[model samples]
Target: MWHLSRHCSGKHHFHAIALVTIHEPWGADRVGTSMSSHIEFRKLAAELDGPAFLPGEPGYDAECATYNLLTPLRPAIAVGAATVGDVRAAVRFAGDHKLAVAVRGGGHMQPYTAEGAVLITLDRLADVTVDGGRRTARVTGGARWEEVIDAASKEGLAPMSGSSTTVGAIGYVLGGGQSPIFGRPYGYASDHVTSFDIVTADGVLRTVSAGAEPELFAALRGGKGNFGVVTAMEIELFPVTSVLAGGIYFPGSATGEVLRAWRDWAATLPEQATTSVAVQRLPPVEELPEPLRGAHVVHLRYAYLGPAETGLELLAPMRAAAPALIDTIAEAPYKTAAVLHNDPVGAMPYQDRSLGLAGLPDKALDKLAELLGPGTPIPLTSVELRALGGALDRPPATPDSVPSRGLPFQFFGFAVGGDDLDELGRRLDRLFTAMRPWADPKHRRMLNFLSPEEALDPQSLREVYGAENYDRLLAVKRRFDPNTMFRMNHTLR
Candidate 1:
């Protein structure tokens, strides 16, 4: 049985207390070996400052929970890491037992089932510290964007946080985080990272930075979780405390006109303005406001880091394209920026796909309208086209391997349901296939947007990173994880 509790008087703020009397040994072919392995695992458990549970133990399922219910985690053992030492111990235990290491933070992306890997839960290690003088935030393990935003906002600053505040800050940055609001102006969240405290496959914790381990740093910036489990990260923050941003929902009947207007107007906007438009089929849920509940609409998300008047003036063209079902765009504090995208919270089954577009000409816009507009019998929940460029196209002062930099737009679509995952997958495939003509010729994509379905295709993965970056990533993989212990994610192998 497991007993969890929170306390403030300790090196770690939280802890998971486990008291197991029964020994449920795994892979017990013989009595002697089973007993020995059980004792060894007990020793490992004793070494951790947090709780450790076997496959059938209580809290294991909760500890291994994932945001995407379609891909559930069934690990050999689950460790609730309360401290950096607990993370180190978990990694070392996995290495000693010849088990792959899997990490869960905010539980957003789970590319694999992790059938027998050692899963480390980082929920206990969440802590954020803001440095007003240096204009940086030190985000500890499992710290969500909400926590970072809350902390940084107190200092009159903000991090390059993504649309969803529930997303793990470290994992997002590791995947080359593309912020809906800050992306075009400030670049990716990974570009602003100063350093990472990660435990590699060898169970050694290393502080990786551009100046320290340059190659490893570059690889980790956009490499996802292929290298190791990150314990903490220090990222640069901006001084702006407020922005003019929010969503405008237009009836789906106006999808074509709104799409064209947004496409044309987005092209004329300055770097201070960032925008995206989505065709959404909202569910009839009580949580949503009445107008948007069960509504088929075109959502135009806008964010401008300039004066409210200028922002309003710039957004006038698209706003006038069609009558709005609901318009929530207004000047607001940066802490409330998540309202712009209003990404769904809580766990749900979903299949998603993303594509990079070199350009979105009139023909492409028409095709999008046909695919996602109300006229068609589309089953997908939402399909979005985010404008990319400006600062996103420029290289950071400290170079990193964040792909999708020069792409004009990113196309993303998802269908939410568990009743028929195969059908949902087919729908996504059909949508992308229809838009193939405008797809980025080189197949360069936003690393963060690469879905589990796309990650499964080895050739597509190679093209997403490009030949040179993929080759370098492979070399780094061989150097750091020679035995391929970190194979749970979109592996380089």
Candidate 2:
């Protein structure tokens, strides 16, 4: 029996007494047990600082919700961890029950269906602390980029955040987070991580960094969730509060010209400038402004950390490449950086594919224009090519497992709609197949951009991480999680 007390405010307090029974270790197949198991589970739930849910429970579905509606999570047990102790408890419970562990932070991407696994949701643990003097931020497990951005903005500092501010900061870094605005200058977000407090398969909380447990540090940087649950991370911050950035929307008819010009012009820019162009077929939604609603356009996303004058000079070529339907390019605060990509918000059913490009020659540009440009009745909502090089092509001071280094470009395409998943999948496949000629021969790809389908193929995963990196990651997985207790994600097994 255990007594727990929680203070709602300075004035109010609540207490509860829970009777817990210690259950013997059970086989994985014995998850569906008798009524006694339910009583025992209820005791465990009462011990947690946050809520826990079982299948058919009132809040199970909501707790296991994912951003991609196509891949809904249906785990055997869902644990909402409000504290680091709760995380350890969940891990221990899963281990005792012979169940695999799956973790969700922002729930942006679910690589696999977590059926029968112990799914841990970290939304209740969100907390951000910033050290303005040291230019560092300590982001908790469930903290989003939006929170980090807001916290850092107060100190006139910013992190290398992704296009979507709603993305989980820790999960993003674990996947080698790439920032559209800061990537070219600062490299992947994982490169700047100073340390991570993680709960491994053994239910031990370990703080790994370059000096302590360097091997685990390297693996966790780009290895995704194969190792454990990261409770918190310390990341370096930049002094940038504003940037010369936004998008230039041109008529779809001009995609060919705009793409060709962007490819050539991008080659001449310095490391301070980052850019990408997307061919979009927007939906008729009220959320989108008048010009973009139900419109077909070529979006030129540009960002520069240098002087505004230099940014304007560099952008002159694309501005003159074709007649613009609407251009929102201008100087803006870093907090409004999402406007550049204008990634759609909220949950929607979608399928995506991505690949790295060795180069983007004129012929390759022409190929893309034909496949995704005007007159092709393509079903893809957006197909984008982000220029990768500069700091992104260079290695970090401390070597990590990020595999996309040296790639000149990254191509990502996705289709939105649930009514016809088969058609959406086929359309995405056709686009990738058509662009294979330009795809990187080594098959190196950005780990963060890897879709669920891409993550499913073992051979493809090996090729993406390269042979040496994958073998090294396997060794780490074996050492830490010998039982493969964390196989609910893109497993290295």
Q: Compare the candidates by lDDT and give the number of the best one.
A: 2
lDDT of 2: 0.82
lDDT of 2 by residue, 159-180 (tens): 9989778778898898898898
TM-score of each: 0.92, 0.93
Candidate 1 lDDT over residue span 243-285, tens digit each: 9999899999888999999989999999988899899888877
The best candidate by TM-score is 2
RMSD of each: 7.6, 8.8
Model 1, position 225: C-alpha lDDT score: 85
Reference-based lDDT, each prediction: 0.81, 0.82
Query: After superposing candidate 1, which stretches have Cα over 4 Å from the reference?
Result: 1-36, 107-111
Q: Which regions of candidate 2 are displaced past 4 Å?
A: 1-30, 33-36, 107-111
List the lowest-lDDT window of 10 residues for candidate 1: 12-21
The residue pairs found clashing in candidate 1 are none
